[model samples]
Target: MDDKAILHQYLRTRRDSLLAKLEGLSEYDVRRPLTPTGTNLLGLVKHVASVEFGYFGEVFGRPREFALPWFADDAEPDADMWAAPGETREQIMELHRLSAAHSDATIDELSLDAPGVVPWWPEERRRVTLHQILVHMCVETAHHLGHADILRELLDGRAGQGSGDPNLSQRTPEGWAVHRARIEAAAVEAEAAASAADTGS
Candidate 1:
């Protein structure tokens, strides 16, 4: 496949990987803040969708067919980073799906060198090509996918690209506990060695 097609595939794969992180999770788990920064599975999906719409739609002078309530002028800061009480999980998921389809169409229609502008970006760097946006979006999606992987693993100990993915070693809960303890022991040993060297004792 060509460069654009390859990048699009990577972007699409990460998008699916991210959504996979939410499968079998409850509303509370998917939306609950797992970090001090309020990072959550659903919130990450919403943020990525908003970003896709902006980069693929607005940046190219294409108008959106749907409204993003979280991005409205009256909305509070970081609104796109979360789902409001009334915003059902289905709605956010649908938005994420729709955003991907919309972005795919844009990528398919434009040439790699097709020029566009990002008004919100620095003036000197506002002008961009489809190739640049494709790379940018791929990196953006992959970055958030990393966060989703951690959040999902923390939520249920389910890890890897998806549920029961063979990419991860098969280990029982007891086995995993032993594995973790081994790593912990190594860390403690390293820290003690560092302290001793610092004190020259």
Candidate 2:
């Protein structure tokens, strides 16, 4: 595949990886804030979907076909980061799928150098091309996928790009326990060493 196709594929991969973090999780598990900053799986998906459409759709002058109520002038701040009580998981997932389709269309139709402007960006740096946006979105999506990885692991001991992905060490339950204990011991040792050095003892 060419450069654009390659970039698109990478972005698609990150999107899939992010979505996979929700598998086998209950609604509460997916929506519950995993971090003090309120980062959650469903919220991450919603935030990415919103930005994907804005970057690929509005930036290229291809107006969105649907509404994003969170973006309205009177909506609560950071509303896109969390689903309201009335918003179902299906709705958020559908938005993600639809936004991905829209982004894919933009990627497919435009050359890498096709110019666009980001109105929401600082005026001096708003000008961009399809290539820049593709790279930006890829990085952004992967960043959230990293968060999803940790959140999913916190929810359950699962981790990796997808189900049964062999990217992680194949440790049995008892082995994992031993591994964690070893790491914890190392951390304590390191802390003690650091304190001793700080005290010049």
Candidate 3:
């Protein structure tokens, strides 16, 4: 395959891996914050969708139809990283699929050296070739897909790539309770030490 074709394939595979991780999850399960930092399966997917649209679609002047309702010009630039109340899992997923199609179309129509302007980027770095943007998008998608993998594993002990084994399930209730208690205890101890140090105790 050609360089653009290779990058496009890589981008699709990474996106598929992320979606596969979310299979069999209830809407609530998909949205549950798996980390203190609010990383979750669906939210990560949403963020990736926004980036695909912004980088591939907008940069090439084929912007997606959906308006980013949560975005503000000057405040909280990473607002796309979280899901808002109105954003459904299906809507986010469909938006991602559409964004992928649009981006792919842009890739098909433009040569690697085709000049495109990223107006939102800094003036000095505002312009780049289609090849540069495609490579950047591939990296961005893969990085966030890795985050989704970890969040999915923490949600239900599922790990690794591809559709996991059919028999996977949460641990028995008693075992899970013990595991939770142990982790919570460790967290409490860590917090106490930090608090004491801050107070010079």
Candidate 4:
């Protein structure tokens, strides 16, 4: 495939993969932070949506009409990394879907060499080609999707990249449960040993 086609495919595939990891989860599960650092499934989705709109929509001058609540002028650049209470799961997902559509439209309408400006970048350089932006966005989307995959797995033991079927061993459910319990017991024992060592008890 050509460069534009390749980039578009990559971005869409990654975006869909991230969404798929969230399947069969309730809103609370999606929004729950899986890490001590506050990384969550729904939060990652929100982050990607904001960046998609910012890079593909705003940079191309087809800015989103709806205001982003977490966005601020003088705040940290990564403000989109977390979800505020006011933002619903449906709203975040819709924004991501809409942003993807808009980005796709812009890509369809513009040539690889079509010039656009990135306002937040260096002022001396006011323009970049559509091809450049597409590649960058593809990388960004793929990176976040990787994060989403890990977070989802940690939440419920689901694993794998993209929208592929989860692994299914021939072992029965009871066998799997026994194995899981053994692993959990081992982890608990290890933690207790480490704690005892630390305390000199």
Work out the TM-score per prediction.
Answer: 0.95, 0.96, 0.76, 0.76
* Candidate 1: residue 47 Cα off by (Å): 0.6
Error of 3 at 18 (Å): 1.3
Query: Ranking by lDDT, best first?
Result: 2, 1, 4, 3
- Candidates in order have lDDT scores of 0.91, 0.92, 0.80, 0.83
Give lDDT: candidate 1, residue 145. 91
The residue ranges of model 2 lying beyond 4 angstroms of the native Cα positions read none
Give the per-residue lDDT of model 4 (tens digit) for 1-201: 998898899889989988787788887888888788888888899888888888888888889888776786666655577667787777888888998998999999999998889998999876888998998888988888889888887777676752345554544558878989999999999999999999996
The best candidate in terms of lDDT: 2
Cα lDDT for residue 85, model 2? 95
Candidate 1 stretches greater than 4 Å from native: 163-166
Q: Candidate 1: worst 10 consecutive residues by lDDT?
A: 160-169
lDDT of 1 at 192: 96
Give the alpha carbon lDDT tens digit for every residue of 90-158 in model 2. 999999999999999999999999999999999999999999999999999999999989999888888
How many backbone overlaps does candidate 1 show? 0
lDDT of 3 at 130: 92
Q: After superposition, how far is residue 59 of candidate 4 from its true place, in Å?
A: 1.2
Point to the candidate with the largest TM-score: 2
- The true-versus-predicted C-alpha distance at residue 8 of model 3, in Å, is 0.7
Worst 10 residues of 4 by lDDT: 162-171
